[model samples]
Target chain A: MGNQKLYKGSLQTIILKLLAQNDKMYGYEITQHVKELTKGELKITEGALYPALHKLEAEGLLDVEVAKVGNRLRKYYKLTENGTKETANKLAEMQEFLKTMQHLVNPKFSLE
Target chain B: MELTKEQVLQIDNYISACGIKYYDVKMEIVDHFASILELRLEEEPDLDFKKAIVEEHKKFSNNGFKKLLEIKTDSVHKRFFKSSLKHLFSFFTLPKVIITIAIFLGLQFIMNSISDTEIFFNILQGFALLLSFRLLFNVNMRNNNKISFLSLSITLRFFNVFHLFTILFQFLDNINGEGFNNIHLLAYMVLFLFYWSGEYVYYQNKKEVQEQYPNVIV
Candidate 1:
């Protein structure tokens, strides 16, 4: 929440990275996983999460499987082949972005 | 703690009452509500089901859900159009490509040979109407399940895709040629391709939706 604006751009990358690690994830599970990973630093609101998931799915980067869980049907999303390739590409892009940001915004520059 | 069928139905009714009618959309929300309600009910033994659902629904406000539907419609249609074109291009392979080209040339020949081009336009409009009716029927049959998928709802457009052809009528009228020119030929080819692509899309989309959501509503 504190750095939500900063994290917003990386939401899709975050999702792909997560799906790449975990074979598949549903809506709530992705949110909870991020919370657990970030130790609550980032909370994925349902409002922001579903649209991202659906968009990725539409772009053919994700595939969905609906399963009956207990009394309700759960929609699970897994990365497609395109999604896997895209994950690698996005992560590489993110890495380069972070390096650039570190140099510009948080450089370990000390006055010599 | 798991929710009872009655509890799940309560969530379904609550979501349906909230204007989220599509099963594909509601399934995720209902599951979210169920998962959270189960955890909440377990955490508090005396919490009311209505109260538990309300708590979860507040997290995803009605406006948020509306925003979700808007994004969903835009994205799904993009996917729908893309998938249709993908399927259309799939015909460009062996054996089938032969048939495709043959049928295409055959139609071109017919267009060139026919003295009255009116029949071709009539067939085009009729075919377009037929597609609308077939896709409309698909939408209805899907709705018969009490909860339809959102993609099916996108097919509810009555007209306008082929309305451009009407303006072409005036273009056709001004021409003093015996047969269609390359311009007119190109238009007919595009319309035929749209007609074929739409048919294949309608067929494939129905299968995909049926596969996506089974009869059980949650």
Candidate 2:
């Protein structure tokens, strides 16, 4: 959860990267996947996750498909072509930002 | 483990309040929630059923659902705005404005070309007719959804009818060599002034009404 807080700005990057790897995913499945990958250290709250997915869909970065599974209908979200390019750019931007923050947080000692 | 009829109805009402309007869709969601609760009861037969249902519901956050629904509503609002702009442009497009100006220029040319009294009166009547229609239509468009169309049209129609009497008086004045003066154009000018003043009043009222009843739906 502490690590998750640090990666708040990169949540969209993480979501985009995950969708780029898979065909599509429903809300619950995405939350479960994040929890599994983080070994329970980070649990993506459904409250935070669904809004991001909906916003991405609204921005045309994601496409949704509703399918009936058993008795319930689940909305699945997948990245669009534009989303793929955006994901790469966002990841690179986050990496550069993270490196800059690291330099600021741990300034190197001068060799006197 | 059957849900009481009241419990089922409570679920239906909750989903409907959330904007899931279709009755069948509400029932489907209610059924899903009820079944989830029933399943929980099966694992622990002594568990408080209502508490279990609420706990299960707490898993799906309300803000998350509302935010998702807002995305859909926002797209609808965007499309509504786009369509409104298209309609507004169609009515007052640059071409339409140019055409109206050309017609005015033509009328001025005809007036200069033929200094005959009958022809001049005819042109004056034509100008009055055009003014009548333009005033009414302009008012209608400016009012838009703010005022009811029936009341607006009736008011404009009354103005149109009374305007004929004013035109007749102006026509009689024209034949008497009293030349087209601004006083003769008072009807149209008054209508335009009324429209502008009405718009100011409407906007002020709208703002006051909105502030007074912030939660009321227009």
Candidate 3:
């Protein structure tokens, strides 16, 4: 697994990106999807995921829909208009940070 | 494999046993717990359900469900606060300002006409008390499986206005019973309108949640 502390700041970015693509997802699905996509290298604990989701909801960055599926109510979160805009900004910011980190860590390396 | 209604109830009981008793919080955890348990059952056909539940519960953070409940409550409180502020601000702008000014003038007129301020103070306190009772009455009118953190937090936001009154009471006591001054009237206006706007916003939020989540009470 990747160092979680390093990934901590990026959790919101990662979640925003996923919601952008998937339209909507519930709590467990987000965690499972992240783990599956990263091949178990990234694991989102319930502790981190929920607070982030609730924070986003409070900020009006996301909207929630609760549905009865099988025997339980599942809260599906979708990006608001502001959340979509924020996702783009966050993605750009993450890309810029990645580029800067790469240049600083390996000055001699060139992707070109 | 889908959980039977019995299994779902058992899971709800298990989460409640873990001390996360709020209905909304329990609903999320119960569903997540059952999902993981069912996945485990699929992977290992002979897996013990009770043992699997314990293992899955361990997978939650060290603080477990209590931590989730805390953060969720905090978020709900923040949202209600933000909404209250928004409502209060709206009265300061556009068409609503007219109504706000009228209410302030009406209160000012009453304070000016009264010879003794004590009666005015008592009437104001009675009005505040009435608002509190009305809020409680509205909540009691709703039927719920159990109170969710959202409902509790929203209801509490209305009561928080009373805390401001407490502060004023303490301030007045410190000053040794000074009669109602102009400043006091202005403070009462702000508090009264704030309480009114906050009640409007917070109660509306509770109503929306009740509509959205059938199991959650106002």
Candidate 4:
């Protein structure tokens, strides 16, 4: 389900895919969602996740909304137009790579 | 039922250490954590609120908040740059520029008329402009971005006028072969350049300090 070398490189694609499916999420919620969906196969640390989120926001790929929920202000992130288009491209690329990996791992499987 | 005053203060200190610039955001996070502790106490009546809060905090690791603080710095840097542009714009204008030209022309006239006073006054004028530039850069160092446009213009105009007057005096002194020598003029230029270089080095060090100890408090 996960590879250590691929983790850092594909983190943004993984985030974009999750956000595309879920629409919007806060920082902690994104980490929790990834953990659950991967069945604990991938654990994204808060340290790694936040800097990426901030960089994406600065680059205009993400938009943030601060909502007052109870006594707390929860910062929610949603995909911007650029982010949405980026997600489609990244997902296609990931799928192609996965297919290539499968062929290399079992070349004997004669599947046309 | 409620957090004690000491507990609230401790939480506030912890949040402040995280280096968040927005006080309201920090307060909200502290309040959220306190509420969570209060809820935990409700389920386990005898549970120590402070201990429970600490335990819950440990779940997310100390570095989590620090990383979030770093993320916030990008926005703060943008605001800082915008303010600097505003300050720079306020310094340039018409009246100020005109006044500088007038000073230059006026000094030329004065040096032509009173050759006796030309050398002394010109040296003084240039020194004063260099001094004023240093003072303005010092103010920038202290982060006073709200520079008044009108005041800065007036000050800069006065400096330009003085500098021109000094040059006129020096030229007259040179042509007449009296009052001051070439060495004196060279000395002033050297001093101005040295002062300017010193200011550049000071600001470069300031940037380094900012990078090492980033604006994010945590």
Q: Over 4 Å off in model 3, which ranges?
A: A1-5, A104-108, B90-128, B135-146, B151-158, B163-191, B214-217
Q: What's the TM for model 1?
A: 0.75
lDDT of 2 by residue, A1-112 (tens): 5667866666788799889888898666776688799888777765567657756765778876655454344457788999888988988887788777777776573212
Q: CA lDDT, every prediction?
A: 0.77, 0.57, 0.77, 0.59
Q: State candidate 2's DockQ.
A: 0.17
DockQ, every prediction: 0.61, 0.17, 0.73, 0.23
Best by TM-score: 3
User: TM-score of predicted model 3?
Assistant: 0.79
Q: Could you tell me which 10 consecutive residues in candidate 3 chain A have the lowest summed lDDT? A: A103-112
lDDT of 1: 0.77
Model 2 CA deviation exceeding 4 Å by range: A108-112, B1-14, B17-50, B62-68, B79-218
* lDDT per residue (tens digit) for residues B132-173 in model 2: 566556654555544222212333443454456546656676
Encode model 3's per-residue lDDT on A3-102: one tens digit a residue: 8899999999999999999989999999999999999999999888998998898888999888889977888999999999999999999888988888
Lowest-lDDT window of 10 residues in candidate 2 chain B?
B147-156
Where model 4 places Cα greater than 4 Å from the true spot, the runs are A1-6, A108-112, B1-12, B18-49, B52-218
How well is each residue in B1-218 modelled by candidate 1, as lDDT tens digits?
A: 99999999999999889888887788898898888888888899899889878777788755758888888888888987776667667645687557666877877788778887767756754665565565446545556765566775564341235445544554664474445455655665666556555556655766777787765541
Q: TM-score of model 1, chain A?
A: 0.94
